[model samples]
Target: MNSNFDDFVKQNVELLDQHIDELFDSDSTLNTDLKMMMKYSIDAGGKRVRPLVLLAILKAFGKTPNYDILTVAAALEAVHTYSLIHDDLPAMDNDDLRRGRPTSHKKFGEAEAILAGDALLTVAFQWISSTNLKDRIKSELVLSLASDAGASGMIAGQLLDIQGNQRHYSLAELKHLHHLKTGKMLLFPAEAALIMKPSKLQVAELVKDFMANFGLAFQIHDDIIDVTESTAILGKTAGKDVDLNKNTYVNLLGLSGAKEELNQVLQKCEQDLTSLGELQPEMDLMILEGFLTYLK
Candidate 1:
């Protein structure tokens, strides 16, 4: 399943590589400079995890996938990439490298990087709005994306994170921070899939549970990786959290305890999947394993 996911991402990368320029060209209203900046960040490579998650959820529902699916997937990815670009700016995580290349700010100057992130974020919504999907699905997708990516979600989480950097947080506070910063966006893919098929309420609830737990687990694993992984392996600088004195799961709970929490979250996600009873147990297991493997 991991191999299949990787292969799928590779294929999607090729498709994105082909269509990215065309996507910009199709919209003449987009300012040329902003379009170029947006494209610059969008073209910068990453794992394409958010889009892959959307595609996986669609596949899990037995939907007949099409180019429209890829378009929406790409939009979600654009939003995520925009966040990364902004997050790496001097005002945020202050990173110099991303995906093993100079960050947007480092490569394009701070002003361009800021504008690029803004353009990518706005273009994400533009792509969604212009998609030929049903009005209801498009509305739901836009709403879900906005809710997760907006101030009350990722932005809120980010604020707490910056604040938490200078202070220690209890487990509850840490969870709140992560739920906003990371978990909400993770939940968006599953929720967006539900929007694509509104009748699947049971499946949607199951997916929501699965995504919530999985998202938390993913964040916990990220904290672990930040402590253990090197820049070469992580494709970005490690130990930044430590340098910033950020409060992380590892810092609060200790490495062993943090790993145990991750396992528990994974276990909960598996339990939710089992309760769903519609999905293949093997597939669920594969996803769980893939999540762990990718984090490691």
Candidate 2:
């Protein structure tokens, strides 16, 4: 699954790269500074996970891939990158590195970094709105993206994390935080795809369960990576979460306990996928394999 996922990711990266360049070229009056900053942040390179998830979901549904799909996928990635930019600000995570490069705030000034993040966030909507998709699909995509990234979702989780400094939380409280901070964003790709498909309630519910469990497992794996991997391997400052006094699965649950939780969540996700009769076996395998790869 890891090898196949990596290959899929590589292909999607190439597609997104072409589309992004085209997007820039098509807009001549785009503010040069903002464009540069946005491009830098987007191109700075991560796993491109959100867009890949979007594409995978669309493929799983056997939908005909179109320009609208790519546009929405890219927009999702834009929103994600914007969040990282703001999250690394001195006022937030106060990080100096991301993806092995200087963080936005480190390379550009704090003010520019803030503006860059703002631009990316707003432009994400612009990208979706300008798409040739149906108005209904466009509206749904916008609403999902806004809700997931807004105060009630990722931002709220971030606030909780900031306030959790030097404070320990119960497992339930920690799971709530993870759901808000990490899980919501992760769930959006799958949810957004379902929105595009307009599936039955049962199928929608299955996708929701699968994504929710996958998101939790992913965050747990991230916690493990923070403690087990080096900066060189992680492509960012290692052990920063511990330095920030942030609560993590690793701190709340022992390593063994966290791994146990991850396994349990993965099993639940797999079970949910199995319940969706129309879902392809390859897609199920892909999602399951992808989750397993994250554990590495």
| Per-residue alpha-carbon lDDT of candidate 2 for residues 1-296, written as tens digits (9 for 90 to 100) | 46777776778788987787777668898999899999999988777777877787777777635678888888988888998999899888888989999999899899999999999999899999999988988898999999998998988888888878858888999999989999889899888989888777877788788788878988999998898899989988999877766799988887888889888888887788677744544444464346456654
lDDT of 1 at 220: 94
Residue 114 local lDDT, model 1: 87
Best by TM-score: 2
Task: Name the lDDT value of residue 256 in candidate 2.
Answer: 86
Worst 10 contiguous positions by lDDT, candidate 1: 280-289
Quality of model 1 by C-alpha lDDT: 0.80
Q: For model 1, how does the per-residue alpha-carbon lDDT over 1-296 read when each residue is reduced to its tens digit?
A: 46965665677667765666678888888888777777777777777667777766766666635767777877888888888999999988899988888898998899989888888888788888888999988988899899999998998998998888677999999999999999988899888878886645666688888888878988999899988999987878998777777899998898999999988888887688677654544333344335445654
Candidate 2: clashing pairs of residues: none
Error of 2 at 247 (Å): 0.5
Question: In model 2, which regions exceed 4 Å deviation?
Answer: 1-3, 277-288
Give Cα distance to truth, residue 24, candidate 2, Å. Answer: 2.5
